[model samples]
Target chain A: MANADRIAGSDVFRPNLTGRHATGRFWQTAFLGATTVGILGLILLMLNIVNNAFGLVAYADGEDYLKYSPIPVEQLATSDLVVLLTNELSTGAINKLNAEQPLDTRSRSDLLALVFERILDREVVASSTLAEAVFNRQAFEADALAKNPDARFVFKSWVTTDFLTVPMSSQALFAGVRTAILGSLMLIGLTIAIALPIGTGAAIYLQEYADKSLINRIIETNIYNLAGVPSIVYGMLGLAVFVRVLEPLTSGAMFGATDTNGRTILSAALTMALLVLPVIIVNAQEALKAVPDSLRQAAYGVGATRWQTIWHHVLPQAIPGVLTGSILAVSRAIGETAPLIVIGASTFITADPSGPFSGFTALPIQIYNWTVQPQAEFRNLAGAAILVLLVLLLTLNASAIILRNRLSARRAN
Target chain B: MTQALSSLPVTDPQDRHVDWAARLRRKPRPVETVVQGLLFLCGAISILTTLGILLVLGNESLAFFTDPEVNVFEFFTGTHWQPQTGDFGVWPLVNATLMTSAIAMVVAMPLGIFAAIYLSEYAAPRAKAILKPTLEILAGIPTVVFGFFALTFITPLLRSIFGEDTVQIYNNASAGLVMGLMIVPLIASMSEDALSAVPRTLREGAYGLGATKLETTVQVVLPAALSGLVAAFIIGVSRAVGETMIVAIAAGATSQLTFNPFEAAETITGHIARISGGDLSYGSLDYTSLFALALTLFVITLGLNLVSRWLVNRFREQYD
Candidate 1:
């Protein structure tokens, strides 16, 4: 111990003077800071969404003003307030008695059940007029009378159930996005039908058949460029080509000859297909490229034709990737609003699209319309629509993830 | 020439009889040539599509320019974009698009590059596996949802902090910020691949010379991967430029293009959306202007893509 200390203390002994330690600490801190900020931002975004959604629910329930009750106007006007109170009590009791009357056995029970549900759902004890002023008829009546012991009954799941069953209308309570949902599904189906073949075929040609010539290079470049082209550009192209030039084909017999507008589900679908074609091609090409050259050579050596090799070996290996890409493309297509709007997708279609050639609206367009409206109820509906859209996108993405995991497992084996 | 001929020995035969038969086989067969020709033709389709778009756009734009309805100087320099009126200037729309895209790039580039650096250089295999997929989820979220998010959540938050008057209902900040968030995953994924492609030996050499992890990354790995990083940036910017729904829903439709982030402004895409909504006659200047704008957008994006491709090919290291 003494000899080591003497050596350390000696003049020839020089301490490690490299800046590596300081620089390492600096960078580690920087990296940690960045990661923290990125992850924190994502968490904040999710929390913000949840918070806003919860706020909407709270506003609908009117729980904040539940404790305050307004004095009746008759009480304020009359010196004999007791008489006014009695009159108010009599009116309420009589209305309750009338509501409970069972002219039809089935009707009486259903009314009783509905009244019970409303009483359970009420948050505030305000005068009927005040409640009417604050909450919508359904929310106010459901909540107000439910809390009043003197009142008839409670409200049930009418709002929740009606949310799904109804179709869009000017009235908030009657409005639903069923038509929009149906239109979205049809558009997605048609988009996939149009894009998958063209995209996969182009990818196959690029990866397998075409030699690495200048022309192939240009095609590859063009596809990448097309992928980045503003989706609105495709919308313009569709309007010009599909709507103006091929209006007859787009507008079918159902729309009538006078209805020459080509802003149908088919036109929107074709435009979206073009918008997402580049993404599909890029993904399909990557998948095709991942298939080992040795596999193709082996298949050919075994007397398999090029078509047979692609059909049997290449496609099976590439299926998961192709499906993943297709899902992503469809998800983007479903979320697209600008192109569809440019291609004249309707904002207020009350009826669901029965065929490809019918005029239609999609969820995004529906949400946009709802958001623009002045009413608070429509905003809530828009939130609900957004929730539905998120759920669909999440499902698609989750399936893609599952597919990718399966592919990874297979590759590992 | 002899060596090259010798490499293909099956073309020659030992005996004269076999040689004659081999010569017959050596001639290019019609079937093989025909198939190759067919493959080339299929490959030409993409080029044809590109040229077709250019030709269509050119013809339409030429018609638009000749029309008296289109004021050429006003279209280029005017700030107002009231198409409902006859006034047509593109400066405001162009300015908004460029400004928003610029803001998006500013936000996305540094964050994306840092994330890429950490993933490629610092992260363990498990961490990389988990973080990569999680980050990609950001990309998968539909842009419409993001738009709603920007409007409903982000806009209100900005209003609360900056005061109600400080932020417009449709300002560039929220759209550009959310767009930046959306593109980060894409840039990170590609940039990480580029950084990972840099040889480990370079890093080891730097470390052996007593350089720190930061020094090695900034000085050695970054310079080496400069081309790929640039490509990633260009692609990310292109994505930001092409984004439509985000700007449409969150950014306002007023084409009074100003650099102020708080102002409601329109983009070329927003103009397309707005004009297409109205009933315009076919072959009108208003209708053809859409094609002209699309053509310009196409040319810019195509130029960016070509540059990226060139950079990748010329500077990217190929490991055999």
Candidate 2:
């Protein structure tokens, strides 16, 4: 104790306190700056998405509505709009529209859409982003209209209800991510169906059944390593195996519906299942490990078999965690673009992915497709798709967290 | 009724199995056996996935290297990477990858490490909760979105700041910058774990010796957690190297060897994504080259992963 004060007084390890505090303050500022950068990055990302999702565009091919009907275009009833559309469209075109969806039963908006698409044939030839439209409207309208005097300049919200309902089109004005959204849902649904039970089973084995054997250890390590593998390599594997080797099954040739090749939703879903398997297994193992030993002992003491104990007790206790992991896995699968691109998702598919065997594109793929295009309007469209994808991701993660919290709360009780 | 009577009353501890010989000789439960077999099959899927990746890459890479136009030595050492003119050198792709990854590390390391230190050592619990989730949101963003962000926002920002003459529309610097943002969450989360693992005793020891809080963190705790921090940094590097969509979208599609971050170039992943998206005939050299690139990526990430795992285990054992 006497030596401690002497040591503190010694000049050897002592530094000037004021300089030390100054250095600490400087480092603290630098660290706070670092944290600020991350938050700023996130803010900019959201702003970019919103700043492009709605915009003003200079579009060509508008005709006077008075020429086709007595009423104005916006005020026209469904029958009036249909009349205007039928009078303007050719017989073959009418038949095609009818075949696509019944024209007689179509709503006013549908008929108006038909009139605009088929009769007026509006296309976004040029555009300004939401920021440009909002902050500098006069300049945007002046420049846009001057560039294309024949074109109509109007405000366009890229995430309108029609944008959610319409199918893909070559023209950016008419393009929507409906098919892509449907495909993503189908892929995530099928992927969860395949991955959940298997991932949970694997976790059960690793946590409860497998002993400290060499093979089990190897399997455990492999799962961890696989979790870290780049997702693109999984796409390559899918292309080589699911698309080529298992084409007969993936393309539905074995099921006698061989309209397409192996680049179907089934193949992509299968690839994603493999991609997320390790993540699910790891999370599920943590969940299973959290199950109390007392529950297992009680089950065994009651003359229950090991399978019965796992199935009835351990599994029921771990269900919330398993579901949480599966949801996270699904979120990862939905945002994945490279693998879908490699496994041959059609960027131009118009038809909704009707089943696992159907050709598909996803929301992320749609974003990528549009972002790569040279047109500025396509970039706006990509922003809208990104917003949708982000919303989906947030929803999935939110649900997972809520599920975990509720289950853990009940456990605490 | 007899079954009910016999199934009753096994609760007495004194009624424990007396006949050990008979119990040891009892028949195995068939239902339990089948259930375990099913579970084992489930566990085997991960093994099958690894095997599948290896087999697919190996089989196609075999076809690629054996082709007459391709030279093994040239493939590794050559500067050019055009497949049309029979040039299969991977260095251009490698260089672009390195340039972007180097830039990414430059941006990510200091920011990520500093943020980790702050979150672990300086942040209060409330600040930690809000900041950590916000960082995760940064992490949870899809890379394709970052790609779009890079192209639409970061690229234009750079072009305006530096002037269009100096910066290309699809420069490596923009992609690398956004890619660094994408990787910050990984480094921060992992390194926070490492820093958190440094025992409290060490910090107290530093404080006892007239060390300030910052001094304790930097001199004592940092050294104690160096192994895990290095592992986290290595993984960050690996992620930056393997990142695809950002480079594919923001970095240029053409391959050339250049260390200049302002210049446009294609990475290995960017090249593979570009070519494979196009219409390539099956079994062509171009298609085979994709597998080769994938194999290279796989091997690199796998090696980094193994080393990081080893380091992490060592660090954990030190504290556990």
Candidate 3:
């Protein structure tokens, strides 16, 4: 016991003197703190988007009734239902209600909007009070009397076929993404058509033909530079070249306009093609470069002509790579909005594009337009549109991944 | 056989040449020459496209420079970007672009480098496998989503913490922050490859000397991977410069040349976005100015990418 006390009382009782330990602890904590902050920032960003996009829906002051039910005609005992219906309907004449439903005074003005919304297309409602009676007594009365009123009852699915069918409207409840989707599809198709051949041809020439001269070195440098050029620069180029220089041809033949303001779908698509062309060419060249020289030599050893060797052997071997690059380029084109918007893609396109040169709106532009609206419903519409854009982008990316995997597997084999 | 050959050579010179030519035709030709030619042509065309892009951009910019309104000094120094008012100073836009890109580098470089170090030297195979793909998914997400995320989410969060006064409805910080997140995977992936390229023998030597793992990584591996790390940072900067939608949506378009991150400012590309949307006539100074801006952006980013390529190539050579 005395020895133990002596040992404890000796150097072991001295203050901790390992300065390195303290420094190590401090550094570790700092590193952990930084990493935690980064991850937290990412989480906070995602949660913020969800909160704004998914929280309680808000309706405009005058349009709040769209979520409620219409008044019941049966509650008006003595008065003629037809006269009462006409009187109640005229109250909000500016609301664009149909004359089909019989007058129901008990329903709030907001609930009446829903009744008119449901009956506007019904032909039987045009002549018969029965159409109004059924809707008025059941939906209008029940919705109006519910104790704890909710807006979800009138909630429209933003992912429905109608979302891709109907045109956009100021009424957030009726607004759909049909025009934007169509525009995006058209733009993607046009971009592929324009970018694929030029990009592929450039890759082919670079990998299959160029001499190892100073000129080739310069070209290589230039290609790298072009790839690094900002996308908005391409937008400016599109505005100048396609919209201005070729306006006579583009606007005249495609958009039926003579002025330079003819920012047709073709102009936007062409601009995007230019934006992604360098990417495709670079990727394609890399893929072509990966093809083994042994294969080319083997083909040549068989006394096959150069053209025949490349066509039958080298090209076939490089095709998977080229296709992979093309897929990536197309995906990039689909998500691009800045160049398109810069080249004058319409923000308020109502009709779906019918041809390559028609004026159109893209998904991103639609989201931007919706986000700027004064009403809360418009914000919801923007969220729904964003979801659509995300899904489309994912689909494109997935296909590219599948293609890349397949190519790699083939190469492995 | 010798006597016959001698007799044939004794005949007319033209007849002998014809006979030699026929024999040469019978022999198999070198088809590899043709294949080499084709490959050469492919390389040439790739070069041609690059030339075409430069020619197009250069010609348009030259046309823009001829206009008296586009004074180079004013464009580089002037603070206001009110193109409608004929005030075309590019300083404010440049400031915004530089400020956001700087902030993004600050956020991305350290985290990405650390993550790369962890993956290469510290993490198990299972952890690496899971982390790599998750990071790639982060990279693959569309920039539009990032923009939406910045505008809707990042901005509001900044508002709550710093108060609305500290952050604008559209501020540079949110855009820069999101951009950094977007680029982290890029830096991490590339830097990991660079760090892994360091010879294991060097690491083992450090261990033999009784150095700790952290010490070996910092003192040996990091220095060895310096060239590659620099390349990654430059590439990250190039990406930040070319980035459009995030800044356009999240960073406001005021064009005030101040250094304040809270202010709504325009970028060179952002100015192009604004001007291109207007009704500027073809060949007008405004329209031509867009091309000049494009050329400037092209030159800057191109320089950055070349430097990055050079560094990466050097790093590869050192080990190879």
Candidate 4:
């Protein structure tokens, strides 16, 4: 220690301290800036969607509804609303809607929304984004009044509880994502059901049973390559296979459907299942590979056969991992737009999917259709639907993450 | 239960034999063989899916080529892509796809690399755990949402800043920018893996020579991880090329042969989507054209993916 102190006092040589500090500081700032760019992009995305979801809308009820209503609009009873709609709408329009789905089976709110959209033709005269409504409220009111003198202004949220329950419509004010949500749920359910067992089985064969042969290597490589294939390619596969070649089954023609053909929930679900299969297999392989050999040895030591050991011990240990993987795949499938679009998901279907063979549209398709509309309010509707999709996606992801974490925590003990 | 079992008298040897026989009798004779066959079938499904994709794409694409109206030479060399009439030139669509992907790479590469450096080298463990998932969540967001964001939010911001004349209502720049954001996490996570994989001994060696932290990271670690970084970049490029919803919704669906990012241009994926959504009948030339475009996309992405996986494997081998 005395010798080191003596050498420090002598100060034989020194590095360029200031230049080094400056370089370190500069790099630190640069990296921090990069992280901020990503984080800011996420924040901006959320803000942009949230901002459009709420705003002031100036709506004008159809001329006939305004003239013939006996009482105020909001206070009208459900039966009275139905009668008003029946009286106001053309019989052809009412029949067409009923043929699509019976109006009597619809909820009261749905009926009311239908009354406004079909019979009353409630029109958005002028709409301001959330920012404009917040900062320039009086200006917006004046502009809206100038545009339509009789139009009533209201602070409306595009993403309401009612939004989740009502079906799609032409009028932006009455459009909802209930049908789309139901279709998405059905697709997710079918995808998980089809993909989980097949994917895990493949993983087990590759990890536990397969010998290092040429065919095995080829299959293994093919799985990796398929995982990187663009989603749109899978769409083409679905179109050709499920929608075309197997149309008799996918379209329910085998089950006696006469009109609908190929563009059914079954085709979309099958496509999504294939699209997520590689993902599930890859994840399951990783999870299965993580299991210690000692566990297998112990099972063998107890005179258990390979399948018995796998089913009783290894499979139980791998369940949480498999579930985590399935959840991730579900999230991917539910949000997938390209494949479903290619496989002919309807852009404007109002009827909920009643069976696997039923024609369907998903949330992403709904959002896409609304965004392309000429009406500014449809963009808000798109934003609202995006919020719904995000919430759904996050809830699924959160549950899976929480489950995986708890399982891993238990394993740590 | 353990105490009661221990307190019981030992069972007779014959009873144990009977129990073993009973268990053996109960076992299904064909269960294991059936399960193994089932697993083999499951594994074969992935291979069959690949063949099916190839067959489907090739079958329809050949049909598209053999049609009397579609000249094979014009399909590749011709610049215009007016499939509604008779012009099936794919170059314009390819050009637009490349332009959007190029812009996305421009936005993503530097930011992704630096973010990776920060996460791998600079972040404390707690910060890293939080930041990593946040980035992943950003990645997990549906691309359709990004399309709406690009159209409603970004284009307006650009218009206000650059004038309405410069930024169109639907242009490639907004879509490309948001697509870049969508892929930033992908690139960041992959590159972070590469950066963190650099041996600690190398960093220590540089530090021992009086090198600064920045000097060691940039000079020693980054150079060693270059192959992995290139792999990451290539993967990002492939992802940007295949991206559909953002370009379809935000970039106008007009098939214009222009190099301008500010102008409206349609990508190959966008063109397929727009065309397929129409009322074209089954077996029509227009509908068949969708398959041809998808074939092109499939081939391009497959090649890019092969190269990326090769590079990644090479990188891993080097470290191992």
**C-alpha DockQ of every model:** 0.35, 0.69, 0.32, 0.54
Question: Taking the tens digit of each residue's C-alpha lDDT, what string does model 3 give over B1-320?
Answer: 24534554555755645665565346555665654555555445545545555776788778877677777778777777776788877778778999889988998998788778767877689867866676665676567667777777778778999998788898898889888988887898889899999999889999887566767788998999988899999989998987887887788877887787877787777677766766667677777777777777878888899899888776663643
| Model 3, span A1-413: residue lDDT tens | 99767854677543332443465456555544444455565555455444444333222232343233254332433334334445445566523434323344333433333333432311111110122223444553344335224322232334555566667765555568888999998888888887777777677766677778887778777777767777776776677678777776666564355433458888888788777877888888887898899999998676555667777888778877888788778777877777886788888767678776678898988887776554545655676777788688788867877887887788679
Q: Interface RMSD for candidate number 1?
A: 4.1
Query: What clash count goes with each model?
Result: 10, 0, 22, 0
Best-fitting candidate, scored by DockQ: 2
RMSD per candidate (Å) reads 10.2, 2.8, 9.9, 4.8
Residue A122 lDDT (model 1): 24
The 10-residue segment with the lowest total lDDT in model 4 chain B: B1-10
lDDT of 1 by residue, A285-387 (tens): 8999888889889987765657678888998888788887898798788888878888888887777688888899888888877766645455556766776
Best by TM-score: 2
- Pairs in clash, predicted candidate 4: none
Per-residue lDDT tens digits for candidate 4, residues A1-413, read 99766654664433456667888999899997998899999999999998888899999976555576866666787777777777878899889878866777776777777777766678999877899889999998998889888888889999998888878888788779999999999989998999999999999999889999998899899998898888888988998899999999999999998789898999988888889999999889888988888999999776677788889878878877888789889888878898888888999888889999999999999999998896789988998999999999988888888988898788678
lDDT of 2 by residue, A34-148 (tens): 9888888999999999998889988886676666767667787777777777787889988988888878898777787667776766777688888898799888777767877
Q: In candidate 4 chain A, what residue range of length 10 has the lowest lDDT sum?
A: A7-16
Chain B TM-scores of the candidates? 0.88, 0.93, 0.86, 0.89
Model 3 CAPRI rating: acceptable
Q: Which residues of candidate 1, in runs, are more than 4 Å off?
A: A1-23, A52-161, A253-260, A400-413, B1-45, B318-320
Residues forming the 10-long window of minimal summed lDDT in candidate 2 chain B: B1-10
Of models 1 and 2, which has the larger lDDT? 2
Candidate 1: CAPRI quality band:
acceptable
Interface DockQ of candidate 1: 0.35
Interface alpha-carbon RMSD, every candidate: 4.1, 1.4, 4.5, 2.2
